[model samples]
Target: MAGGTVLVVGGGLAGITAALGLADAGRSVTLVEARPRLGGLTHSFRRSSRAGDLWVDNGQHVFLRCCTSYRRLLDRLGVSDLVSLQPRMDIPVRSGASPRVARLRRSALPAPLHLAGALAAYRWLPPAARVSAARAALALGSVDPDDPAVDEESFGRWLARRGQGPRAVEALWDLVGVATLNAPAERASLALAATVFQLGLLESNDAGDIGWVRVPLQRLHGDAAARALAAAGVRVELRTRVGRLPTTYDDVVVATGPAVSEDLLPGDALDLAPGWSARLGSSPIVNVHVVLDSAVLDEPFVAAVDSPLQWVFDRTAGSGLDPATGQYLALSLSAAEELLGRSVAELREWTLPELGRLLPRSRSARVLDFFVTREPQATFRAAPGSRKWRPATATRLPGLHLAGAWTDTGWPATMEGAVRSGEAAVASVLGRRTERTALGATA
Candidate 1:
């Protein structure tokens, strides 16, 4: 299979990683993307306002130190310098119920103990609830996310059985779960939730340390990837849609969204019932971007509790806005089912006062501009029994593979999952090639 032609039918992180890995392995790779730009769901666009033209990302995407694959992809893209990782895992969590801000900063202790200090002192939960939460976290460490029984149960139900009340869920579990899983604890699977908590928080001390892009996502991913792919001698076809799988390539990687993949793949390719993609479903994310007359939020980002606002990020630096000008903030609202259909005016009306409540300075600051970005089908719905819908990398059809966050990457639908899926797809493809070569040699 040396010098074999490989066709990757998506320009996302998954497809890009697969293309690069294949090309580097001596395959003639061609990446086809229907979008004009390469960075699939994670992209940026220009917005005009009185302040100036700003580059706004579709959503505020962040990564953790545990996300080795995504970070490696960033290094490969040569844009590692364009992002910033925290020296320690520190999250400024603010609650609307109280004026005081709580911090989820990890200490220099060992696994589980590293966060004990922060959890013990958390003001959001009662003293007993905090202890219960800690105990539940320890219990979660023992829960194998790969088990089929775990996938059948909901995280909320599991937490409830362990004495986690609604307060603990809202103040603690859902704080991280909703953002990562894109579904609240009641609806999210225990398996996916366990994976996020164990790998991100429990397994290692520094694994949960946060990192975010310093520049626009397009520049960090799409543009950098385009340059990297070109340098690697991989052919890229932007704005090219494949209605049906091309038979010419030695192997094909369908790395698009589940719906798109379903459309392109042969009916018999996957071992699933009809309408699996539809059954897998999707969740929505609504990003409310606001420009103020003056700076309100001091930190780079802050998580919210007891309010509709989820996470607020200071986008002044990344949006290309002048410091002298007002401030730009983007509020990332995950599991935003109700807010998806709300009008911009309605969002502005509701969100302004909420921001004022969270950040008191926002009440006095005049709004320069306010807008919204919605991703209805953001990620595959990580509900209970979702694993059954997510197929493995290899399909029943030979030389055809699947690569996406929706694939069976043993992780949630994050940048890490997408990159891991791509790597897995590459391994599957090359592994099959080696098997065939060995068989031929034996014959």
Candidate 2:
């Protein structure tokens, strides 16, 4: 397994990460992708506008400073400077329930203590509820993410048992949880909730600092990854779908989605359990892109509460839109079931008023263009008992491994998880030897 040919299927972040790692380790690797470009989830498309042609991302994706693996991938791809991290952890939140806009920014302090100032002044919840939220955070920090019992129950019920009211869930937990876990507290697993909170918030003050790509997603992920992979001397095959196992390679890594993985995994060779594929479900994400005559948001991004808007990002600069003409805003709605089937016109009609309500500047701004992008199966639904469905990187069949966000990486389905899954797969493949992975240590 040291220097033989390795076939890595799927050109997404996971495949790119794996291919780069294996090639850098002096292994001959062939990377194949069904799509014309790389960066499976994080991609962009061209949209014609009166101002000029612009590149709009499939969705507005962001990562936290805690996502070390993904940041490492960026650094490896030589595109780390293309993204921007917040100077400090700050989130401007606008709630339809209240007229006042609340800011969730950290102070100069240690872990957990850094958030005290922001949460104390958080106007979304009552003073009593804020205190309750603090207590809940402390309780959540104690819940070990690795505990199996924690996955059997929903996070919403746990919050209720701890005296968390509806206001606390919407204003505090779901505000962060929905974006991170891709489900409401009632629907998400307690294990993932605890993991997101403890690792991103409680572990360190800087962990929750948000980072986003300044350029188009295609530039940051697809194009940059291709450049890095080529420079690494890995043979890349695009627009080539791998339906069957190739005999040219000694080892193979399936880095596709769960549904795709089921089709690609040879049942006769791999002793997969019955209905193993059905165990992992899917979730949807809806993104609304709007081109306005003028700027509405001063900050680059903001989270919304008591409204349909989950997170809104000002992508004018990212989209390369002409500032002299107007601005471009992308509204990201995770776990978007209701909006998935709706037409773009219908979505535009509904979201424009909401934008107007949240940003007074948008009321007078003329809508130049509006569009929507939907990922029906954006990621596997991280429901209660989902952990049992997720398989390990090492498969029952030798020389065959699974690498995707759906794989067991402790974290949920994210860019960080995807990259970690690749690293884990490489670690499993090279575990027989004493080779170190690109992630630094073994496995």
Q: Highest lDDT, which number? A: 1
Deviation from native of the Cα of residue 96 in model 1, angstroms = 1.3
Candidate 1 deviant stretches above 4 angstroms: 434-443
Per-candidate TM-scores read: 0.97, 0.96
lDDT of 1 by residue, 174-282 (tens): 9999999999999999999999999999999999999998899999999999999999999999989888776777788999999888877777788998799999999
Question: How much lDDT does each candidate structure score?
Answer: 0.93, 0.87
lDDT of 2 by residue, 103-158 (tens): 99987799999999999999988999899899989999999778899998899999
Top model number, TM-score: 1
